[model samples]
Target chain A: MLKLDNIKTYYGNIQALKGISLEVKKGEIICLIGANGAGKSTTLMSISGIEPPRSGSIFLEGIDITGMPAHQIVTMGLSQVPEGRRIFPQLSVLENLDMGAYLRRDKEEQKRDLEYVFDLFPILSQRRNQSGGTLSGGEQQMLAISRALMAKPRILLMDEPSLGLAPIIVQQIFGIITRINKEQGTTIFLVEQNANQALKIADRGYVLQNGMIVKSDTSSALMADEEVKNAYLGV
Target chain B: MKYFLQLVLAGLTKGSIYALIALGYTMVYGIIKLINFAHGEIYMIGAFTALIVGGALQITTGLSPLTILAISLAAAIFFSSGYGVTMEKIAYKPLRNAPRLTALISAIGMSLILQNYVLLAQTSDFLPFRSMIPNFPFLTPGKSLVTTTQLVILITTVVVMVILTLLIKFTRTGKAMRATSQDKVMAQLVGIDINKVITFTFAVGSATAAIGGVLIANHTGQINFYIGFLAGIKAFVAAVLGGIGSIPGAVLGSLVLGMTESFGAGYISSAYEDVFAFIILILILIFKPSGLLGRNEIEKV
Candidate 1:
């Protein structure tokens, strides 16, 4: 489980997340849906320590990890499949996965996790030797998620994994996310612009607008709410 | 034909040194995205350290040429790595968050400081290799035998390149280094210690330049305090000529530049040798901005 208590983050003079607070429970898929510049990514970044919250605290598994370096946070079982699927382009698909488990000490466990990842994304296994840059956008997204899974982290944070993929691939990726949650018991905090698909699988969901969390509810409640439907679902 | 053979010999020796030095430039630029102008000064410091240890201490033993060569290489690697790690920690790391220009200016400042520091210590006079280590012939061809120095230069350069290539290609640390270079954010996200990788990059580069400095000293038989500037510019040219951040490109560029200069001086005009090197650089930039072995990088918006 993770908790962000009154987190504030900024880029130079502009505030990106203004005292936003949220909680994600263990083995749950919690999606934050928002329009452009709605602080969804910022929230994820704050938790992952890529963008340290200017104020307040973040707790992972009841331990305060506020302001720790990104790499340290990763070693503490928090991993992010960053925006734009920023996989190492020059590296082979296998090498990219190895990078995800950079902090692991157990070589046998690493091999086992690698096998699990390859099973989750068989395309990555088939193209293990292919350069990451050569992969299609959907494959790259798969590699990105599979890479995060390689860490065997307690929680996985994904930023817009479906941003530019085709609808079918998006569905496939979403399905994998559900399976990963169910099988590995990996808590997922997904930030997405596709409100409908995100809410479908997300047990709990939050709506963000202009650096503020406008709504937070169980996925069904958020779906049935008229305001959430009109504002985000375009009903 | 004999003259051509000699030119090739000299070119190969000089080319190898240039390749070693240029590797420093290319490696640093590859990871940090900024030119560490003071890298040449690190080389100079290495040569000076060798001079002090070999000259002042008389540490040279007349065993085999191989032993002396190994000791010299070790000394150079040690001194240059020290200076490089210190320089990165003090000068580069502070400006890492600043703009690229700030780091560049700091590098220039460090270069000047290093030059002045050597000038003050060793004085402006060019120094020779300490006489304790008598020259032994390593390359002999009937009447013309290449000095142990030239052989050492070629051998060391190749050795450094091989070690670096292996380090970058196959090692876990090397993989971390490549990842860090590709994307620092993602690298950090994956638990790579970016600072440590950057420091290791600096160490590797400086170590290569150290070997280059010792070889240059032994081959040319003299080194002034300000030698780093000319060598730095030439190595930078080689780096750019080979395709800015490519390792093999640096080696290839160095060979081309060295051969161009050697043959140019031998057949064309000695005074115009530097001009020829720059001309080739300009031509390469104009025709193919990415050197011979460099791949074009595509940026997505």
Candidate 2:
């Protein structure tokens, strides 16, 4: 489980996230939906320690982890698949996966996790020798997710995994996300602009508007709510 | 014909040394995206380390050439790598997050400080290394031909280049290094210690350059406090000539520059030797821009 209390983040003079807070329960898929510049990505980044909150406390399993370095947070079982699918271009797919388990000292566990990634994304296994950059956008996204999964984090944070994918691929990715949550019991904190699709599978959801959480409810409740539908789904 | 062959042989020997030194520039630039100006001084430091160690251990000049070379190389790699790591920690690491220009100026400053440190200690005098390593004039039987020192330089350079190429292409650490060079943040996310990878790069580059410095001292029979400046500049020009970040390109560039200087000095005049290398550099920049083998990197906005 993770908690963000009164989180404030800034990019120099501009306040990106102003006093936003949310809680993600263990083994649950929670999506933070918002329009452009709603600080969805900033919230994920703040939790991952890439951009620590300016004035907030972030807790993982009741332990304060605010202001920890990105790598240290990763060691503590927190992994972020950054917004742009920032895969190491020069590395082969296999090398990128190897990097994900960088902190793991157990070679056998690394091997097992690599197998798990291959199972989750079979395309990655087929193109294990291909350069990370040469993969198609959808495949690259898959690799990025698989790479983060290689870290075997208890909680996975994904930013805009479906941003550039086709609808079919997005559906396939979401199906995989559901399976991952069910099978691995990995808690998922995802940020997205696609509200209708995100809310469908999310156990619980939060709607962010201009850096503040505007609504929170069960997935079906938010899906059926008139205001949530009008504001986020455009129905 | 024999005389010409002899000259060509001599050119290759010297060319190989330039190639070795040029690799240092190329490798550091490949990963860090900064031209390590202090790379040349690493060579200088290696030579001094060899000098001190050889003297302190009482490994006299009369020993077998192989033994002397082995001892000098070990000492050179050890000391130069230590100096390189220290330099990175003190001078480079602090400026890493700063603008690239700031890091570049810091490198130049480090180079100056290193040169001054040597100047204070060694007084800028040319110290002669022994000339017993045979200048085997095999091609020009009975005439002054390229020495064994030059032959060793050529052989050593080739061996080092081949090994480096293998290391970069085949090894996990080498892959990690290339990954870091391509994207530092991404490399870290995957579990690489970016600092350690960078330090390893510096150490490898410095170690190679150290070998070159010792060979240069042996062949030329003189070492000076300020010798690294000219050699470093030429090697840098070589790195740029072959494409700044390309390894094989640096070697090819060094060969071209070396041949140009040697032939120009012979056919024209020694006075214009420096001028010839500079002019060639300018022409390469104007015409190719990416050097002989450098691929143009396209940046998407």
DockQ leader: 1
Docking class of 2: acceptable
Q: Which stretches of candidate 2 lie over 4 Å from their true place?
A: A105-109, B59-68, B131-146, B299-301
List the candidate 1 regions with Cα displacement exceeding 4 Å.
B59-69, B131-142
Report clashes for each candidate as comma-separated counts: 0, 3
lDDT of 1 by residue, B1-301 (tens): 8889878878888789888889989988989988989988998987887777666344444455445556766888998998999999999998888999999999999999999999998899988764323455444545654656666677777877888889999989999989998999899989998999999999989998998887787677788898888888888888899898899999999998899889999999988877877898889999999898888998542
Error of 2 at B238 (Å): 1.6
User: Candidate 1 has which clashing residue pairs, if any?
Assistant: none
Q: Indicate the residue-level lDDT of A37 in model 2.
A: 93
For candidate 2, chain B by itself scores a TM value of: 0.93
lDDT of 2 by residue, A174-211 (tens): 99989889999999998888888888889989989888
Superposed Cα deviation of residue A98, candidate 1 (Å): 1.1
Interface RMSD of 1: 1.2
